[model samples]
Target: MSSFLIICKSIHLGNTLKIANEMAKILECKVLEPEKVEAEDIEEAEVIGLGSGIYYGRHHTSIFKLLDKYSFKGKRVFVFYTSAFRKVKFLNGCEDKLLNKLRKHGAEIIGVFQCRGESRLLGGVCKGRPDERDLARAREFAEKLKKKFS
Candidate 1:
C-alpha cells in the first residue's frame, strides 16, 4: 500500500484544515499540521498533499518553511487551497510558489484543487464556504489523485 501525507497550515478558523481533513478521509491518509511533520514524514510519503488557507495572497509562511525544511525528491505531490475567492486566478501566486518549490525538490505534481473559504479578515469574505459542495469537489479530486498515484 502507498502512504500518503497531508500537511496543512490552518488559521484560527481552521478552514484549510477542514478541507485537508476531507481529503484525508477520502484518501484514507494521515493529516498533520506543518509544525508536527518532520523530514522523515516527508521522505516516507509516496504521495504528498500540501494545503493551506491564503494569507496575504499566499499560503501561510509556515507551509513554505516546512517545504524548505524537507527534501521531497521523486515524490508525487498534490496541492489544495481555500481562499476568499473561488477563481483560480486569485490563488495563482500561492499555487505557483508551491509548485515551484515542489519542482525544485524534484517532485512531480499530479493535481491541484481550490475552493472558496470563509475569511474573517477584511470584514469577512466567502462566508459559509468550503461547504458541502466544495468538500464534495475535494473528495472527487482525492479519488482521482488516488487513482493516479496509488
Candidate 2:
C-alpha cells in the first residue's frame, strides 16, 4: 500500500492527469483512475487526491460517484481540477460542489491545485495552458503536501 494515492479522471485533454502525474512524482504515489481504485488502496493511503476536468461547472460524474462508493471520513484529501479559466475566483465555483462533498464526508482538505486547461470548445479556448508554469506550480503543491505529511 502506498502512503499516497491520487484518484484522477482526465477525460478531456489529459490536463488533470498531467497535474496528477506531477503530484505523484513528488509524493512517490500512483495515479489511478476512479474505476481502478480498490478499497484497500483508499484505506492505506495517507492522503488522497480527487480530481478531474470541470464539466458543466463541476468535476466529472465519475469522481462524485467514486465518493459515493467509498467514505473519506477522517481521511486527508486534496482536490485538484483544470478548466478553461485560470483565475482563482473563477475556479472557486468549479471546485465548490466537490469540496462540499468532501466536507460532508468529514475529509480533511489539505490543499487545492488548479490551472487552465485547453478546453476543446469554443475552438479550443485556453490552448497551451497547463504549460510549463502550471506544471511547476503543480509540482510545488505536491512537494508541500509531501513535506506536510512526511
Q: Give a tens-digit lDDT track for model 2, residues 1-104.
A: 33999999998689999999999999999999999989999899979999999887889999999888998998899999999875565645888889899999
lDDT of 2 at 45: 90
Clashes of each: 0, 0
**Runs of candidate 1 exceeding 4 Å displacement:** 88-92
CA deviation > 4 Å runs, candidate 2: 87-92
Top candidate by TM-score: 2
Task: Find the 10 residues in a row with the least total lDDT in model 1.
Answer: 85-94
Q: Against the unseen true structure, what C-alpha lDDT does each candidate score?
A: 0.86, 0.89
Clashing pairs in 1: none
TM-score of each: 0.93, 0.94
